[model samples]
Target: MEVEITTEEKILIAARKVFIEKGWDGARMQEIADNAGINKALLHYYFRNKEQLFKRVFAGIVGKLIPNLNTIIQSEQPIFEKIQAFIDAYLDFLLANQELPLFVANELSRNANLIVGAFEENGLKPMVGQMVMEIFQAIENKQIRPINPAHLLMNIVSMCVFPFMGRSIFQKVLMQVPEEMYQELLKQRKKEIYEMVYHSIVL
Candidate 1:
C-alpha cells in the first residue's frame, strides 16, 4: 500500500535538506518552500518562522540518531559483540543519512548545549555510570584491556563519524577518489572498524 504523506511532513523533509546543506543561518524560508513545492504563506502557516522550523528539524534528526548509542552500553552481549553491533548499526544509520554527520558536527560546534538538551529531553542521558560499569566489568573479565571508557567512546565516535563528516574534503580533494570507490570503501568500514577496535583492546 502507498503511504500518504501529509503537508507537514513534506515541509519537514524539505526543511531537513535545506538546514543540513545551508545550515540554520544560511537557510531561507523561500528556498524551503521551493523545495517543498509550497508557498511561503503555507510554510509560515505550518512553521511560524525559520527558528521554529529549524528546531523541529534538528530535534527530529538528533532524536532519531543519537539515542541509539545507549543500546551498545546496555546490551548483554560480550564487549566485542556489542562493539561489532554498534559499528554495524551506527555506520548503517550514518550511510543512510549522509547529510546528518555534517549537520550534527556543525550544530555541535555552534551550540553544543542545544544538542545536549535534545538528548536530555529525549531521555537518552543518565547512562554514563552504566557505561562506565560495563567497561570496568569487561576489563575485569579480560575481554578488553583496562582503559578509560571515555577514550574508548571517543575513539568509536571519531572512527564512525570523521569519514562522513570530512567526506567532501578527504574523498574529493585530498584522496581524489571516485564516488564509486569511496562508496565501496565505506561499505567495508563495518568490518574494518570492528577489527581495529577489537585488536586495540583485546589480548
Candidate 2:
C-alpha cells in the first residue's frame, strides 16, 4: 500500500534537498517552492519565511537522529556494545545524508543559537545526561578505564562526525580518493571508530 505524502511533507522534502545542497545562507524560498512543485505564495502560506522553513527542516533532522540515540541509550547493551552500536547507527545516518554535516556546520557558524535551540528542544540535553551517567556507571563497574565522561562523549562524537563535516578536504586533499572510494572508506570508518574508541577507554 502506498502512503500519501501531505503538502507539508512535500514541502519539507523539497526544503531538505535545497538546504543540504545550498546551506541556509544559500538556499532561496523560490527555489524551494519550485522544487516542491508549489508556487511561492503557496509556500509562504505554509511557511512564513525561509528561516521558519529552515528551522523546521533542522528540527526534523534532529528529531530523526535523536530517537535512535534514545533507543540505544535505553537498551540493555553493554558499554562497549553501546558505543559500537552508536557509531554504527550514527555513521549509517551520515552515509545516507552525506551532505548533512557540511550543511549543519555552515548553518551553525551563521547562527549557533538557532541550532543549539533546536537540539535542546529535541531532547539532546537529557540524552547526553543519560549517556554521561551510563559512562560513569561503566567506570564504577570497572568496565572501562576511569575518564571524564564528557570528554569521552566528545571524543566519540568528534571522531564520528569530523570526517563527514570535513568531507571536501578529507575526500579531495587529504585522501584524494574518488567519491566511490571515499564512500567505501566511510563504511569502513564505523569499525575503525569503534576500535579506536574502545581501545582508548577499555581496561
Candidate 3:
C-alpha cells in the first residue's frame, strides 16, 4: 500500500536526511527544499526559518523516544525485564533514526536551552524522579547491587548513545570496519550490553 506524503511531511523528512548527513551548519535551506521537491518559498511558508525547522524536527525525535520511556520506567516490571526491553527498544529507536543522534548532539552544542524546553513541554523531568524511586525500591529489595541507580542509569545510557555519536570514529579510527561488518558489530552490542550490565549488577 502506498502511503500519502504531505508537503510539510516531505520537507521534514528531507531536512532530517540532510541535517544528519551535513549537520545543521552544512545543511542549506535551498538544498532541503530541493530534496523535498518544493521551492524554498514553500518551505519558508511552512517552517519560517532554518532554526524553526530544526526545532520542529527535533521535537518529533524527542516525542518518538520519550513517551514509551516514561511508561516503562513507571511500570511494575522487574528491573532485569525492564533492562532487556529498554535496551532493545532504545537500540531499535537508534537504528531507525541513524541521523537523529548526531543532529541532536550538534543542536545541543548550539542551544541546550531549546532541548530543555522540549523536555519540559514533553514532561520528561517527572519521569527521572520516578525512575530513581523505582530503582531505590529495587535496591532495598536486593534485586540489584547498591549502586546509585541514577548514576548507573546514566552510565548505561552513555554506553549506548556514545557509540552511535562516535560511529564515524569507531569505524574509521578504531576498528576500520567497512559498512556491512560494522553493522554486525552493532548487532552484537545489543545483547552484549545487556549481558555486561546483568553480570555486573548481580552478585
Candidate 4:
C-alpha cells in the first residue's frame, strides 16, 4: 500500500532538496512549489516566506545530527569507548547524507547565525562542556596524554567531517577512485578514525 504524503511533508521534501541544492539565497518558492506539485500560493500558505521555509529545513537537519551527540556524550561509557561510538554514529549519518556537508558549508558561508542558532537551541554547549570534562578526567587518571580538550574535539570533528566536505577533490581529483571504491573507503574510515583518535590521546 502506498502511504499518502501530507501537504506539509511534500512541501518539506521539496524544500529540502531545493534549499540544499541552491542554499538560502538561490532557492525559489516557485521552484519548491513546482517540485512539490503545488502552487506558489499554497506554498506561501504553508510557510510565510522563503526564510521561514529555509529555517524549517535547516532546523530539521540540525535536529537529527546534533541530538545524537548530546545522548552519546552524556552516557556513562569510558572516554575511548565514547569516542569510538561517536565516530561510528557520525560516519553512518554522513554516509547516508553525503550532500549534507557541502550544503551546510554553503549555507554557513551565507549566514553563520543559522548554524550557530541551531546548535545553541539544541543544547550543544552543555554537551561540549561534558565531553571536555570527560577528557579532563581521563587525563587526570592517566588514561590519555595531556592534550587540550578543545583541540582534541576539533581534531576529531575535522577528521570526521573534512572528507565529506572535500569529497569531490579527495575522491575524484586526488584519489581518482570510482564511486563504489570511494564508498568503501568511507566505511573503512569508521575504524580508521577511531584508531587514529585513540592513539593520538592514549598514553
Candidate 2, 18: how far from true, in Å? 2.0
Which of 1 and 4 is ahead in lDDT? 4
Per residue, candidate 4 scores C-alpha lDDT tens digits across 1-203 of 99998999999999999988878888899999999999999999999988777777777776676688778998999899999988887888888888998888887888999777756664544378888999999999999999999999888888888999999999889999999998999899999988999988889
C-alpha lDDT of all candidate models, in order: 0.83, 0.86, 0.81, 0.86
**What pairs collide in candidate 3?**
none
Q: TM-score for each prediction?
A: 0.87, 0.91, 0.87, 0.94
Rank order (by lDDT, best first): 4, 2, 1, 3
Clashing pairs in 4: none
Q: Candidate 3, residues 8-116: lDDT per residue as tens digits?
A: 9999999988877887688899999999999999999999988788777777776787777777777788888888777777777787777667767887898787777
Tell me the number of clashing residue pairs for each predicted model: 0, 0, 0, 0
TM-score-wise, the better of 2 and 4 is 4
Best of the two (1, 3) by lDDT: 1
Which stretches in model 4 have alpha-carbon errors above 4 Å? 121-126
- TM-score of model number 1: 0.87
| Off by more than 4 A, model 3 | 121-126
Clashes of 2: 0
lDDT of 2 by residue, 1-203 (tens): 99999989999999999988888778899999999999999999999988778778888877777789779988999989998988888888888777788777888899898788767665554377788998999999999999999898888889988988998899899889999998888899988988999899999
